[model samples]
Target: IISPDSVRLENGTSLCSGRLEVKSNQSTQTWSSVCQQDFDQQDAEVVCRELGCGAPSVLQGVLYGDVEPPMRTTEFQCGGHESALLDCRSSGSDRTTCSPGKPVGLTCSEPVRLVGGASRCAGTLEVKHNGEWRPVVYSDWTLKTSAAACRELDCGSAVSVGEREESSYRSVWRIRSDCVESGSALRECAAPDFSFSSSSSFLNLTCSGKPSPCWDNLQL
Candidate 1:
């Protein structure tokens, strides 16, 4: 999911978690890592937002394999709300050296939400896109599938994963267990189809306590 944003994460288990890489504005087009010292929470926020993900959960250096530079010499100064990382201000001068293996490795949380419930952990599941939160309809989903959502929400183990019958049909996102099992963020998982239907059910979860590693180890 390399976007036109000229910033990307590499050497990660998935697109949502990886080593930070930025494309050079040079005519020939090169990609380089950013010094961890040069990037911050504000920069991390913009990177996550630009990539259509939740907030930055982890930022560590050398978590991704140590790669040497051809790195960006300038420091990024993001205001914390830019649409793209490149949209931020850069230092006028070049940094001569960065410590070895000090480039950033970042992990962004999944863009999943729970609404209309008693707590942040319990509610109808929704995935975000463009700006609006879209409810999802998942016929093939299970507790295994909801487990990932719990992890994303920082909720405990998925106590119950079920559906509630709604009175009317409306447009909602469609999610599949296979795609979610592949472990992509709900929005990043392929196109979670959006359409109006009489499915009459919206996916729901009641998450409580702490999450279980068992959910992570289950087979689909």
Candidate 2:
């Protein structure tokens, strides 16, 4: 049987967005890409849930890369409530290998949103990871770094950034600077659990566009 948590996304900008790959442990540890044609909307939903990401937002064939093998030809029949792909019922391969289609490439909605601000584009930043939302804490949060979140929101360019000082130490997701600048989605760049006490800071951003994705390119 494939490991329940063994499914992963590759080649896209973030963990929640990429080509689908599943690993089997019953035999030699090998990763197999799922053919796009065999994966349906419900199958995609299970993959997103298994990755602890938000709902499925985008699915297209070969968007991340070329058709890859060895492909898992089992057609997944999911009801959309299962927590993992392995728990869903599946059918054996109609073909022994991938013949006509590319592997599945998916982009789940970023589990990212702004809160307590003037609009969806402006507010204190929070990201959902591993099923929980937390403020992000990082050392290098310049406009360049902060702008990544704005672009992810499709909320145009970042207009301004502010900091908030809080009380005692609380857990936060520490982001890696290199990861954000690399154009990865903010939630995907989270490093590890972190805590900050006195004089700790949080980011509140304001974007130029109100509620829609306006800017095609992020302003430096």
**Highest lDDT, which number?**
1
For every model shown, what is its TM-score relative to the native structure?
A: 0.81, 0.81
Point out where model 2 deviates above 4 Å: 1-5, 68-70, 92-94, 166-170, 192-200, 210-220
Give the C-alpha miss distance for residue 207 in model 2, angstroms.
Answer: 1.5
C-alpha RMSD for every candidate: 5.9, 5.6
Model 2, residue 70: what's the lDDT?
56
Range of the 10 consecutive residues with the lowest summed lDDT in candidate 1: 211-220
Residues 1-220, candidate 1: write the lDDT tens digits. 3355587889786667799888876676877888888988889889988887777878788887888764655799999989999889988676767888889888877677888898878888888766667787758888888787676567867889888888656657777777777776666664555566665688888888454233222110
lDDT of 1: 0.76
In order, candidate lDDTs are 0.76, 0.74
Question: What total of clashing residue pairs does each candidate reach?
Answer: 1, 0
Clashes of 2: 0
